[model samples]
Target: MHRTRRLVPAIAAMVAGAVLAAGTVSACQADQKPEPEQSAAAPVVPAAPTPTPLPSAAPGTAGPDAERSAWLGEQLREIVDAQHFDDVVNAKTGKRPPAMPNVDVAVIELDDTGRPVAAANTLLTQKHPHGVAVPVTRDLSAPGVRWTHWSNSVWAAKKSTEPLLADRGDAPLEFMTPYPASVFKLIVAFGVARLADRGGVRYDEVYDYRPRKATCPDGRKPGKHSVSWWLDAMLTYSSNTATCALLMMLHERDGVAPMNGALRSLGLPTLRVVNTDPADGGGWSFWGLTMTALDTSRLLLLFTEAPGTLWRTPKGDPVTVGVLKRSSRATLRKMLRDQGLNQALSTANWCGQDYPAQGIPHAVPKRWIDPATGVVHVEDRTYRGDVRKCADDAEVEFAHKTGLVPSAGADAGIVTALPGAKPRRYVISVFSNLGCTYVDFVGAYDGACRYTEKLATLGAAVDALMTKTAGRATATLVSGG
Candidate 1:
């Protein structure tokens, strides 16, 4: 079932890229039915720039005149190499993260013009290289980076298999990997805000969100919510119901075509959103979303980077049109900061909880529907509890989104080196599909869970790397480790 559904999006992505390159997207012609309009209170504001064709370099290399980028990449390479991720085991669970995990990582500094370039490096895994350094703004392409048909550069490998070009040497890696859930919320959030920036949608307008697929927390029906309310609910709480409503709204406003256009206009061709509606018998809800670590890092920069550094056109011309407005960026940042699902990447920021020998039994509550009555019931149960790893003292604020399903775990965000700390910032995006198919929250949250622990370790390492580079002697990185 999953494989079949996955194929649909892959096919759609191929077609969408083709249509986009021709300067006419047939998908945008999504039955122009009468749709609700934005409230009159907010005015249209065209903001920043258009997405442009980026230059490409080989994995683990930088563009012209980018020595700093090379150094940063080297720093990131050392951090990942030190972990020995593949063999690492959680002491509590006594389980490895993934016998074979599909993973991709991108780390790029955001201090400069926000052009992602770092040292070229790769990690050797028992199965394959843990990652090929396709620095966000460098490499990952041939003949240069083009948004159209970007998938041609992807390095798709079966578990424990090497890339076909591994022996030949020069292979441009594609960071745009498919994610089942969670991480794509960033794209959804970006879509809503981008539409608002273009004046086609307003955050203040109210929309009705009916609960259908997932059961409500207390059997409460979700009624009408403002666009902003729904955005907050979808982003902060990871609410599928709210996300459905926003997707419906985007579909009604001429489908995913507009959002794709906005993405391309912003210099991200690898990032695309397909409207997969279960009501249309699509089988899955958010599984149609796809993107790369590099693209995600670039997208996050739009929220925090100076306007001049955001984006440019294919012709190298300044793009003042179709950019995210300042107001929208602030709102999105606030939503990210308020994210409730902080268990993954932010795990390093949490203080550890000591558990007794009994292993801290925990009562887990869940709401489910009976097949016979279509009614929701809450089941309270207890299970072996997990202990938190000791938090790090790396003083940084991570405003980001996390995506997790049994098959995958990911976190992407902007890491700010606390206020009054010389103003250092960077972006880190990670997606690891460890194939941990836990059926329930308790199983997924088990203290020794591989994905969770992996995320925490990666976050901590990156945090440490950032701290070490800051020369702690002069900068006051607040103690939050």
Candidate 2:
């Protein structure tokens, strides 16, 4: 749901030319009472400065790797130049020149053997009007990069809960929105999995959603449902209510004390849940959770390298930890791959899974149901569709998660080429607040769509760099095929 907050005066000036979209609340929070309206709009500040191009290889200098690196650098520069946020600003506000915000990019490439062969880290910068090139800061919390919330993946990986299948019986796993915990449901599902692991619950356990006495702070009654339904809704459809139910069940079974202990044992003591769904709370949205890009990248790496160590302790001891069982990891990866929303990372055209498929699989059909009366109001079962495509036509595979808030956008995951070729994989994480503007409604400016296109373009550029360099190098390094 849309919660209004005062905008920064400076951001207002920067985006004076932007056309604000009509304000709309989240459909997921329809059950909860509307929050008090906010009076002021917050300034939508840009994060980071324009990226500085990677240095080119001196003419006729060095070896083949150097030449490939130089060529890749040039390709990257072209990609960065194409994303000049100034162009967006200039188009919106013709009077004043736009300032260039930085784009934070991290690319790690693995060899045919799955070992890191090369890594590139750089910040692109644009020449200022005064002819000076300033570097953009890598602040994770900056308005430009703050929209990313990769912690959901970690929560899903570490959450332990009881299977709820027994209690659910033959009940259908379905419900109406806005379901709670859309993205946050991963945490709740983990809790349920843990419960099931300990013999405390079953996957069939059913929960009623009819309004009744409950623990929720919003005084809202639970929907007619069960744990299994909620878990599926949370991951596949991002149901808000289902997420709340899972969190509440986990806490009631045994406070977060057990969950926190599990985190400590996994070397993630800081990743803890502190609040219920923001849709049910009175505060800034997403303030209930905290995370950083670096931590997120490390978590994804752990998931990818499960049953293996991502790092070692300062004492030289290997910290081999697998957050989820191999089966669970596979399940989560499948869920991520089957994500209903494909705007950001999927736009890269590299998510080789069945992306061209139309409509979300588990999404609740559009209909009106009164929780109070248990009566049907309206029924629209037609599936909504997503038609965005990658700029390039090449098929690439990626298992990734994307995060979006009012002022930020982010994506992270593992990418690999099609089979047959030496299996090379890369872990790419991108966080950006460059063109994110505070709009009143969920469908605000077209800028977010443009930003997604930019991300897809960058993904393509990175794919080219890895394929051209490593593909050629490995071909030459290997013996006769």
Candidate 3:
């Protein structure tokens, strides 16, 4: 079914206002509480006792529940078949906007230890989706594995007549498409965290804001800040300047090599962090980084059990490693938990109208002063998008990242069903070339709002499936003697 979600203010307008109000803000910032300054990193905690090696269960006998896997697979298929990609037809243009023709989706159930549970009797090999399947592997032996591919011709039927900004012949395998700022921020966070864990960087260490070529999307340079401060800004506010500074730091310190190497060590080679500075032979303004939905999803699964979690090595052997120190992991999670932006996946309707707030810690009061006019607007959750508070409904927490550029929009995160509800945890990652930068209901049709609604629908459906099958046992096969 085509679900409709309330439309929030256009991001382009927000960017314009931010430029007038404060020149350093990016287009993706939303009204939320100010994050406290982190002059010092959180104290690191000692490693916990090593966990026992979890035996890989025979398909469907143990590990992640097979039923859940089957349910998720069906949901993905339905979404692809429903053709939500081109549901919105532009009234004036009389053409459907471009979207990610190849909509890739993956949902993996995680055990308490955070390793992917093997789903029994699940379809490991996907059939030809959208008439052609992109060249990618579905590693059943890898932690949390299930892959599905599909494309809607309607979305891919037409491309924007807009001239290409930069066309390097043929995108690389990891360069599915230049992901948006939000997704890039997530990758930068992982790289920085990995560096800190290896003692190559420190969270509290201050650095001068320097960039080879990258800066805020608005062309302003960011001020100097600590590694932890930049991380908080990048993840929480989607600050392009902060993202650029961190990326520059990574490049100067040769941090990208280690981050990509670490991902390969975990058996993910298609995911990579690139240098966006064009002067350095990278397109800092255009296509900076490349990532896949499945790889992105798997990376998020790691966060579910970071700081001493057992995972698979590149050789498929079991290994327990602390990807992030307990303090580091906790600090990052808190920043995401209090994320000011919730208009994308977190706006999905989990509980009904009674509890409007779909995500965690009821929507707080939102107040913003118009920098252009000096008029202060004070309303209860007024400017903070359409999501409202629901104290009674099941509280779900979405600690994830979202991306929005003129040509593409993406959202990926770990969805957790909090207390007072059946404990269900899963990771979902979605990416598309959909144009979600249009102003809502003005010169253009509400395609961006509709696209967000479609994502919310998927989020709601995933929550339902996970909740319904929570605690259900994996289907087991018995031999007839």
What does candidate 2's lDDT look like per residue over 363-399, in tens digits?
A: 1111222344323232211112221222133245565
Score every model by TM-score: 0.63, 0.53, 0.66
Highest TM-score against the true fold, candidate: 3
Q: Considering lDDT, which of the candidate structures 1 and 2 is the better prediction for this target?
A: 1
Residue range 1-481, candidate 3, lDDT tens digits: 1323333311111111100111111332222212111111100111122222333345423233343444445545554434344443332232333432334555665544444542211111113232122232224222322221111221244222111112323432212232333675777788888788888889999977754543335354647888888898778656666776777788778887888788767755546655455222123432235565666776665555522223445575543335666676676776666555454555432223321223222232122333453232333222322323333443566777776654345677776766676766667666755434322222332232223344454455555655555554332321111
Q: What is the C-alpha RMSD of each candidate to the true structure, in Å?
A: 15.2, 14.6, 11.8
Off by over 4 Å in 1: 1-65, 88-99, 112-127, 135-180, 210-222, 278-287, 311-315, 319-322, 348-350, 354-394, 420-423, 438-450, 471-481
Kindly give the number of clashing pairs for every candidate. 13, 65, 7
TM-score of 1: 0.63
Better of 1 and 3 by lDDT: 3
**Deviation in Å, model 3, residue 74 alpha carbon:** 2.7
**Tens digits of per-residue lDDT for model 1, 1-481:** 0111112101100000000021111222111111111112100011112212222233332232244455555556555554334432222233333333445566655433333333223323333444433343333212121111112112122222122112223433322233425667788788888888878788999877654543221222456989999898777656655666777677667646877887766556656665454332122322235666666776776776343323344444443312678899889988876655455556422233221111001111112223343332322212222222222233556778776543456778877765554444567777654323311112333433224344454565565555444431121111111
The regions of model 3 sitting more than 4 angstroms off are 1-71, 90-94, 98-100, 118-181, 212-216, 278-282, 285-288, 306-311, 319-321, 348-394, 437-451, 473-481
- Give lDDT per model, in order: 0.46, 0.38, 0.46
Ranking by TM-score: 3, 1, 2
